[model samples]
Target chain A: MADRRPRKDAARNRAAVLAAADPLFARCAHPDDVTMADIAAAAGVGKGTLFRAFGDRTGLIRALYEARLEPVRARVEEGPPPLGPGSPPRRRVLALLDAVLCFKLDNRHLAVALEQTGDASPYRTDHYERWHALLKELLEQVPGGADADFTAHALLAATRADLVAHLADGAGLSREDMRSRLAEFAARTLGTED
Target chain B: MADRRPRKDAARNRAAVLAAADPLFARCAHPDDVTMADIAAAAGVGKGTLFRAFGDRTGLIRALYEARLEPVRARVEEGPPPLGPGSPPRRRVLALLDAVLCFKLDNRHLAVALEQTGDASPYRTDHYERWHALLKELLEQVPGGADADFTAHALLAATRADLVAHLADGAGLSREDMRSRLAEFAARTLGTED
Candidate 1:
């Protein structure tokens, strides 16, 4: 298809492209194995469409990551107590971390691919800055939140996709156990542990 | 120049290669610039010797990382107070983390090369395992030590090479500030804060 299109059709094509890329990333043993050509063929779109849609492979992986993250991000942003703004600071911190951990666990392969590609540091991304800011802000609200910035980074570091994958795949740690341990670890940092 | 050299000369040549490669990696804008041939020429040896000793670029990097880490590893295992075996658990934990962070700061370029190459997960390395085990042991001695294992991993994750580079290169955080921040973060996790 040409770059020009009806808005609705453009949106539909973008959705199709993302949807097509998801499982292809999930099933591939390596991220580089899934190319724009593969995504285009799977989505029944031309290679030009995939490029025009996502700019390139990194952009596509990033879009898919952001799309998959939308639901959880929304919940953390506006859902309810615990994850949303309404919860007490400590509880909110834990909830935000749990949400990040869960997201990584649920999308391990995609997360790994997106992280390991583009010769870019995952720390340099906008979403990373956003999450770090949110966590740092929430930590600031806690009583002993003096080192909120560093503490936030430390907490997020624990949930890094590669770490999660190592724990899950190499260490044989169950997801539930991983979550529980992370929650407990965060609690220690927040000074809220029993 | 050949692999069949007497063991003493081989030892001398191996040390010479690591010595020559150190400044090259430290000075280069990119790690790839410090090639095996470069090390060979700098070490006054043949390229065949460099390959015979270290296998390839990734192998050379890994060897350098381990070689550089030997002193700090020794201090943690049996040296004096703080990082040594005799410090209090909380203090020892802080010391170990500081040591790791300082090492990364001191070896930024080489560390990045070792991590970026090989496509290996850093978590699976024997040294990482050793560090985790050591941290877990120290955390186990802290008052609320129930989650020592997870806490050890979380704490170490904060010092990951890429994150260290991000803080140093992009964020432009001063080394002292980074050290202070990490110390404070570890203090929080160790439950030693006021």
Candidate 2:
């Protein structure tokens, strides 16, 4: 009973920390401004608890990002037509990219913070590999005879967090406009444009 | 003659620094490891002169990149068909993307170094604006009626330095293979595949 209690408490604390960190990241003027101390304070936990739950600031940011992305991941994994397993390859491809673009648009700050965390290439992450693999698999099922591997990378690059932020913030592209543009680009790549 | 001598010396020092820095960046294990002191030492100039000439590490790297890119810029500006102004719009788009991919591939470390500097989004650079503007203008002239502005950004994103580095270094994509993939992707985007 005692051992189980600590495990439950750990899980609850993790949830609290992620929930508290999300809005802090979203509202900060710069990602660097949102520190572990700030997140710990907001979560009403000690700084040691924050460090224990997530190893560092980057770790906490990544956890918060993943938590926010969970719903989108679920939709793509097992939801309805156009995003899940039930749709045509071309439609799924467009939907997947649009989902990525929309997600980045919605979580612009967190996404940028995660990508900009360190010297490591963003492409090295398991998250990137998963997306690239899924996209490549879908592109192979499409009719274009494109190089699915490179095509997947090119398609995802179009929705890179920094690029999305640039379009959204610097160029002032509306969410609908960015999504439409990505859909058009993906359709042309798949040779399925109407 | 006395005033001209100092100007001539500065110009000579600038060229020497770039020449010395080129191989250093190419051979470094990591970009941050090659400091301004290393560059000044290689060029036989004082560190103060290096800083005075280029402002900082980012500025020096940018200048060196611009120097190396001169041949490409000149070719695209006025040299010949395909890369130059005389080629058909679709062909020029293909050529322009190819040039960017090849340039990134050839100068992988230096390009990555310049892009990785500090907190700046690479989209804000004047260098990027020039390429995007040129590509957008060319895409507008193409017959497919694609959204030239967004399409230009998407196409250029495919050849981003870190993406090129990831493909070249991490994925082990050969130079020729990378070039071919970019060409194919650009052709499909421009709707000019034969």
Candidate 3:
């Protein structure tokens, strides 16, 4: 499979480009400030090679979004008790808040970059749908009196990245404090009967 | 009193500029996508006059931020019980969620732009700090532990504009659903004994 060598190299180049672009886009306050050449330079390749690898900036961004899902899913599956499967629905809800907050805080730069990329892309839409589905499943496991879907939407809204970043960086609030408040808010909203 | 006439005209021009810029900036996916010329056209003023009034793009954005605050405060104070001052802390908390969600939904464009601006400006920093203080006061009244400040910060983090947008627009969750979930989450986080 000597012919496959270039194909494998292309794959490596794509990954390397994404890895470098993630932080650069995330940390910048404005996405427009980043150029294709910048991304190519950061990826350690020529500008032409960068264009060939991702086709365009939007394609590169989409790849970044796709790459993030794996870690996010793994974190949801095996990171911690409340965030993972072992804890009760109530505790898991709280854990999810913490996990999301932590993720945003850790990747604040990349998170903002992706959001600023414009609304034409389906990346964010798909990501949130998946998150909403997972949250809905958790709500179903809780008290079953009211509409779980609506409740799940509200909970997700309250824990958005902009809100998280505002509290953590803008408002100077600590992670633990943010988690506790959200946990309390979730428990009451979910009718935990505590 | 002739000098007063020019000053009054300037004030009116400034107001018109801010009003026009708010909607244009808000509706745009990227704030930079909005140029000074677009704002001037929206304001129905001469392009030169727009530049003379606001000085530049950043100055216009700052004015927009400040101008919106008065309306927000009024809504928070004069709106219905849960959002206003008349209801129980619990209901008030829910009302706050409703108020915020409605604001974001109605002004989705502006909300997204302002959030992307981040805390680069002193005005943004102060605006966020005030909200955290207000949240802290509400949490302190809830009879929880002395860690009310922390709790308030956490709730704020979860309820910022980006997160709300992510849930509503990006995630395709309805406003009503988000409100209900946040209300429950707030109740539990506040240590509701019920």
Predicted structure with the largest DockQ when compared to the true one: 2
Ranking by DockQ: 2, 1, 3
Interface RMSD of each: 1.8, 1.3, 5.5
Give the alpha carbon lDDT tens digit for every residue of A24-131 in model 3.
877676566788988889989898888887777767776676677568778787776767778888778767766665676676655555555554432256666777
Where's the lowest-lDDT run of ten residues in candidate 1 chain B? Answer: B115-124
DockQ for all models, in order? Answer: 0.58, 0.62, 0.24
What's the lDDT for candidate 2? 0.87
> What is the per-residue lDDT of model 2 for residues B26-83, given as tens digits with 9 covering 90 to 100?
9986788788899999999999999998998888988988888889989999989889
* Candidate 1 lDDT score at position A109: 85
- Candidate 2's residue-wise lDDT over A40-134, tens digit each? 89999999998998888777877888888889989999999889888988878888998988999999999999887755788988778888999
- Cα RMSD (angstroms) for every candidate in the order listed: 3.8, 3.3, 5.0
Residues B55-118 of candidate 1: C-alpha lDDT, one tens digit per residue: 8877888899999999989988889998998888888889999999999999888777876663
Model 1 stretches astray by more than 4 angstroms: A1-17, A33-52, B1-24, B27-51
Instruction: State every prediction's TM-score relative to the real structure.
Output: 0.86, 0.89, 0.74
Q: Superposing every Cα of model 3 onto the true structure, what RMSD results?
A: 5.0
Q: What lDDT tens digits, residue by residue, belong to model 1 across residues A1-194?
A: 66676588778999999888899988976677887889899999999988887888888899999989989988888898889888889988888999999999999988888777635778888789999999999989988675787788888999998889889988899999999999888887777545
Clashing pairs in 1: none
Please state the error at residue B174 of candidate 1 in Å: 1.6
